[model samples]
Target: MPGPDLKRILARATSDDDVALSETYVWDLASLFSYSPSASQAFALSFTRRFGRTKSWRVAVKCLHLLHRLLRTLPSDHPFHSHLLRSHANAIISLNPCHFRCTSDELTIFVRSYALFLDEALFCLQVTKDPSLPPPETFAKKVEEVDQAVELVSQLQGLLDRAMDCRPLATAGRSSIVRSAMKHIIRDSFMWYATLWPRLMLVLDNLFQMPHRLCIAGLDIYTSAAEQAGRLEEYYDWCKRMSLCGPYEYPLVEKIPQIQVRAMESLVENMWQLTDSSSSSSPVTFSSSPSTLTVSESGSSNCVETLKNAAINVEWEKFEEEEKPLIQFGQECADWEDLLEASVDCSWTWAPLIFDEPKERSQNNGDNGLRKHEANLQEYNPFLDHAHPHAM
Candidate 1:
């Protein structure tokens, strides 16, 4: 059983009241985890049970927030992280069954979105530390590093989107808990924004070193990041409207550098020019003293033109229009003697010894009378199959 303090704090933290979680409770929970090994186990069991029993989105969001705070405040080497990792591995704290409900549809949507963001946060805390790109060295190595950075940046952008989706709509009330959660999300968004810029620049710097196809792909990645960056102001304004940001101003969104765009465009143009020049040049002729082989450009062009201009009608067979043959199985009747001859007995040789005989019980014996009553009750009531026979 969990200690009284643990139970009280958990109840208060996950209550339906519209209030922000107290910082004191967070520290208290951390202390409980550090206090004893059994405390952590108790917390896990009680937490899992409470989360499993809740249907309201508010309670679910509060529970996630509480868990998130603990994971953030705890030290890296704390036993709590290891315990959580094991619980997650064993599916003791699963998010698969999280279905939060609310009277307001908009609030429900926001809760679900916030829940998803918290889910990602917990995964990052437990599974992976910060994964950075390797230092750029060789051409192949540099390109590979840039590719990895590009993928990470893309993932960060997606996480940002998920965080941004945790918004209380205009129709919804600005609950303190919601604002509190948004404050954390806003800070996280800023950190991601800061990380995003460097990765985007890294991709841009190495864009030209990639192969022609990868060069285009890298450019596309940069464009996507730029577009997402452009939406930072909208997100900030949303936070301001929700009153989540008080006295603090969000950083200005950076404009995409024109020079980088021009460089990409110029590289693409040069590649296309080289391709056109090669294609327009005279056809090569190969020769040997014994025999000479030559390719005629005009003849090849004419052949291509003929193939493009020629039209041949094709008719396809419609299998759906034809009737498929139905399979018919022959039903052969066999006599009992024949079946018995072919059948091998799979029953145990001592089956008759284990089988119980239906014997009459005397009412004079208490145990026999109880057994007879149970047999009669079970026979008449099919629903009692799962009920304890002795309960009656």
Candidate 2:
């Protein structure tokens, strides 16, 4: 139920000629910007207000189908052009106020078409990739790619901004539909960012200071939208789910601070274990300690390495597999679970002996006390206070 422009665009597009097809494609793409649920409701209201439901409802439904078909053809660089097609498709959802009569068949077609568009867009933005794309040629090339990726992301952000700024065409009863469309537009935009930013980080070699900025921008968009839309709980939950999977393996150590290193380490480790459980039947757990610890033998002192090596060396398939459980766990934990649950699972069989003791006590007791303390927190707390103020 768009204005005359949309109808004209569609009419010209569906004509039996190449010009119509190409025009249809571009028109469809442009129409994406206007096709929010809210906007549709507004359009429907405008139509109904001027021409009564009986006269205008069928035309509105027809417009929806034409828009859907047009959205089905957006191109992408990947083999699965369907991926790109979906992004625009999701934008064409119907808003509340029942644009036309609510027969089950019509509603089913509307929902199916809208859902298909969303799925296609989500897949294209998050899943479709050409393995054959040339790797970054040099550090500079990597940086440039990162910059380009950032620019593309910014363009996307601008589109959302415009969508939010537009006035809905309907003035009265269809407000909810207009709002729903706006929400859909914003949500899809954020989802696109979530899917693409991480991949861009992987492709870029040396981002210099870009990753930090990108992360901050992403976090800002997520936080702001969640807060404004009263979706903070859902947003946090989604973030937790996404982080558990550990999206990309850019050399983040150089970009993030040391204090944040442990947090990132836990996330990375959890992600790794989650992704590659077969590598070690026992889950990989992280300890809340620096890399080195102390030990004792024959009344002599020794140093032991407690930190696992901090490099990611996993295959992409394994990473993807592990990410699912973590994402699911995050969703489950988001509303009720403590934030720490999202951290690395630090429960290891041997960690108490190696890293959970005072250096002096470790030298004398051979880490026996540390092991005993882990089994009982009341004992561990008292022992830790007396033996390892530095460790605390």
Candidate 3:
């Protein structure tokens, strides 16, 4: 059980009136418990209420901070753990053109935070011990809830799609909101795909192994919803804009194109093979291959080959393009190679923790006792340091 001091800190942390609690208080409260079902529920409710009422970008940021902190203390089996998870799923549903106040910065924060939360939750659930505590049935229920949320997101996305297809709205904020909302929807969709891809693949594998065929119409709900919402073109435009933003920018920009290319290639190959096998024994055969057959076969092969060649060409062209001289441009237009390099290198300095072994166990038994003692001493040292600056 946590001490009374911890309860006090948590009360202050969750209070709407004091949004600027100290970082130390936040960290201490988070470390006190391995999991807290009630705390998780309280945090979710507070975040939803605050976020719903505020148009402030700061509110979104604060909500994200609180969410991240709450999630840090929640284990998958905790009663209210799913509540926080569902809140995120619900966010996608609620991020509609009507509900979302679309500032670029705010939308970016929301999408990023949403993605991070889902990623962290999935990771914790997948990697934690005692996975049976949540049970498969409970997980299935959670997934169904997520599915409903996805439907809502698709509906919201459709609105943005319609707005983008039509002429710009007469109102000042309306068109901008629609465009920004569209970006957010596309981003959310991509994040959904990223988060669900592994689980979907596992389901597909199970279906392939089972005696009975799997009916996956429910899986296509997102697609149908997007089509109904009128956002297919908007989705495409969003992807195009993301690609044009840079050559190799953003966390998963490279991944999106790669996944699409691989999926398209696989579909084309499978269809072509099926067609070829069917045509080989057909009664009616033309001297040339059927037009549909030829188009499908040739188009698939040609497109893939062309794309591969283009990738090689682009690599060579990048070097040449970087060397070309240009007329004097403003400071804002200056090349940021140095800045980019510095940032990338800085990331590498922490590679041990980020890229090293995912888990490690301490081998020194002697050190464990010492570590415990040190922790106890540190815990009480805060009080001892009240009268001495150096003691702190």
Candidate 4:
């Protein structure tokens, strides 16, 4: 297709005498966009670059309107759509409102174009069932599309900075663009596309540090999530590491102590099961009082019959079962935190623990004259507090 009409029109439009009027060139360029899958950037670029340079504000408005009209016929799958849209936007925006004489109305062209592109990018994201699990090509394409929209939004943020500096009226639109772009960045990185914990942490780290108004809302939600999951302690620790540590408005409320206590109680209750099985195999030896019992080992016999203390008794096999999993989990965690309420038992910092029980004090045996056991809930737990830095 030799496009004789296009060539003839361009020849006339470019003639030295006709340089002042670009209206004919603008309308013809919009028409050129309708040419199907083979639309070339050269014509669209020429239209935007040439017509947008009109010295008259009214003529610039006309050129902007022409670009808008061209937007209507943009085929859904236009091969050059992004390039065309971006070029058109830059051309109008380069007419930077205040000093260069390009009016605020030209900005409307960019706003509309960007809104369309961003909306389409969001639509594509909706189809991706799992962003992390998407096929490689599909994933890359979707991410690239999102990145492009985010980049455009960044431009809007810069525009807002300028608008605030000189043109207050342009501030609202540019602020809106910044907010919209920030939302997309958050949604794509944390809400929809986040597949790994580190990535989610990264988003939180950025949000916690950003002074933008949007970040306040983001942090509010983030704090609520951490509170719900009982990881506020660890979460804020990372926040500090990223230099994004903010005032932790939420109080650290933990149900972990209660949960841990309940688990220990359950293990104690279940201890009888193992004891019952072991009783037949291992003979029990008793003394007048466990405190007076002495271990008289004649050889390296690996068996130690229970020397039951007058106050407390422990099932060794059952305690091992209950603590082993916690020990393994802690060792695997690689966490150096002094206190992680959620997984405190999984801390590997503790020394090799063989046995643990609360100590007891007998107060003259009272009137009964028999020994009594008083277990201190907090002051005398014998287990090593590997999870607490102060304990170490």
Candidate 5:
């Protein structure tokens, strides 16, 4: 049984009015019960967490959608939204921890992470619309972060899904929330594809490559093997690969016309934005109120360390590396690194499991960029490879 103090903590965290604080409190509660499985189970089933995860999945689903909603409300220059993303990413990743030898059933976590990656991309697009973000050049760097995440996701899908008949998110099949999430993913993905493609083309050279050009699943637009395939065919093929992407069915044959019009319209609108960029002398501006975690203050290192080691905590630096590019897009974006320099702030902690290959080889058949990444990682870089004494 929980004491009065525990009840107080739980009450504060579950409040919808103060969501940012809820992150910290829930994390605290999660850690408090980790060592006590009975307590953890009991607490999880307390009609709150259990219902959030099982009966309705709204709370667990909020783990994705609510964050997206919150991010959409924030200005791109606001530092806290990114922090929330990192924290949310870490929490989601922890839910699906994977060891190399783990069975196929354990791949759910990996799949969830992939869906989150797309969510992050959507958030970036939403925020970057703020005139305050950096220039397009720096914005282009965000593509790398997305690509890297995809590489990791593809690896998980490939090796595990190879031998198993796992329906992408079969673990949560009973939950309608997952189904709704899939629809959101498709809607947002088309928006993302529509928005980013023109921006990349205008600033980047033709010689430069985007892992799959405009495709998120690394589907090859030009494949010798599928000589008869056209744009619609290519789109449907890539959509098929993102099968576990969310809880929805693949938007295929029956849905082709609807998707075609949406995607084409989105592309045209982005093209207009691209043309408008050069002519605009002023861009609209906005800002977000800071959250407690991103308030640019520090507590005791011991307390910080405990939080860092807590299952919910993520590394500040690695997350910074991944997120810096998104904020880098325009000249007016916020300075995240300087604002939270005192502490690592927060890092996007990923699952420990690393895959040697994507769930399935891409139509490109070049291993996308993972092979080169693996090779480059083998070479030591004093800057990136070394741990900071402060972090230690």
Candidate 6:
């Protein structure tokens, strides 16, 4: 039921030809959505029908790009988002079984997985639409809210995984449309996956505070995050494989440090054991002496008796069996320093995170103002050399 202009745009947008979806066309659709309520609804219906019958991966991917842009560019209260959500909820444009009648197995895999990614994007829209769902920053406050946030984050991670699976074959990777789609996938992956990784870590951190809640059913949280972080690394690798990295342009996107996750796992494991030990402790206490030590004694003699009782309770057999004391201050200091360095290096920060020195130069040198300011500061401080003994 689309008007002639709307049909023409949709036809061009979802053509079988190997062309990238036009941003202008997408914006045109957005402009039409804003034209009037009836116009938006009509375009939604027409696009849904066209998208449902999509038989080509090119057409399918283009359609997803259009829908993705619409969902992304439009306001949260836009009727189009609600319309698509209602359509999917009613099974009008379901993507569960993407039967894109493609002949190539690679194309089939790409289409099906990309279809699932789009489905998750819709779910993300639905989550955002609901005012009741807690924001990620505060979602860890309650068990129920944490569950909701975890479910949402998990779905976003699945979307990232599916996007990874939608990688193009060598031949297809050269296609303009395929490359364009991969670029969009890169943006979405960075925006959703990168953002969600930190949020998941925050959830784990907050949950860790309540040992009772964590011990009850939260063990999987750590393993799941570690696994998802691995997938995220794979995604970064995929980006590199796609040649998305460039010196002035496509710097490798930052990711959560794996060391942070390992450190968290270590803490969680120790906490789990501590909680278990506390819960399973017995009521009986070890007695210091058989007869010499009594509950009550004079002040001076009490201290002597306490020392005597402590000496009596000592496992003299174990001490006699060992050749030296069990304390090693040197190794302990080394371990402490290692832990401190890791914490300082990888503590979660909202600003741009760069781990490698090569990229660190880019971050530092990219800002002309910062470089000039540093130069000025060095001029003011004569002993500003890093290797100088008097350097601060």
Displacement of residue 150 (Cα, Å) in model 1 is 1.7
- Please give the TM-score that candidate 3 achieves against the real structure: 0.30
| Residue 372 lDDT (model 3) | 93
TM-score for predicted model 5 compared with the true structure: 0.28
* TM value for model 4: 0.25
* Tens-digit per-residue lDDT, 1-392, candidate 6: 34887889999888899778889998888888787566676676777788777677788778877877787889879888888778778777777777776777776677677777778778773444343445445323444555555666667667777777777765767767777877777777767755565546544534443434442334455456556666666766766766764423332444444444443443344444444455431221223333332221122234323434444334343345553433446655556667666656653324787676577776877798678998898878766675576756
lDDT of 5 at 146: 41
Judging by lDDT against the true structure, name the best candidate.
Answer: 1
Cα deviation at 160, candidate 1, in Å, is: 0.5
Better of 1 and 4 by lDDT: 1
Task: Decide which is better by TM-score, 1 or 2.
Answer: 1
Q: List ranges where model 3 is wrong by over 4 Å.
A: 1-26, 31-37, 40-56, 83-392
Clashing pairs for model 2 are 37-181, 38-177, 38-178, 42-170, 86-121, 87-121, 96-177, 274-322, 275-322
Positional deviation of residue 123's Cα in model 4 after best superposition, in angstroms? 17
- Tens digits of per-residue lDDT for model 5 on 121-175? 5334232343235534642564554454344333332322221222335454344
* lDDT agreement of model 6 with the native: 0.63
Q: Global lDDT for candidate 4?
A: 0.37
User: Candidate 1, which segments miss by more than 4 Å at Cα?
Assistant: 1-5, 37-42, 75-78, 125-137, 211-217, 247-249, 257-392
Q: lDDT for model 1, please.
A: 0.64
- Ranked by lDDT, the better of candidates 2 and 6 is 6
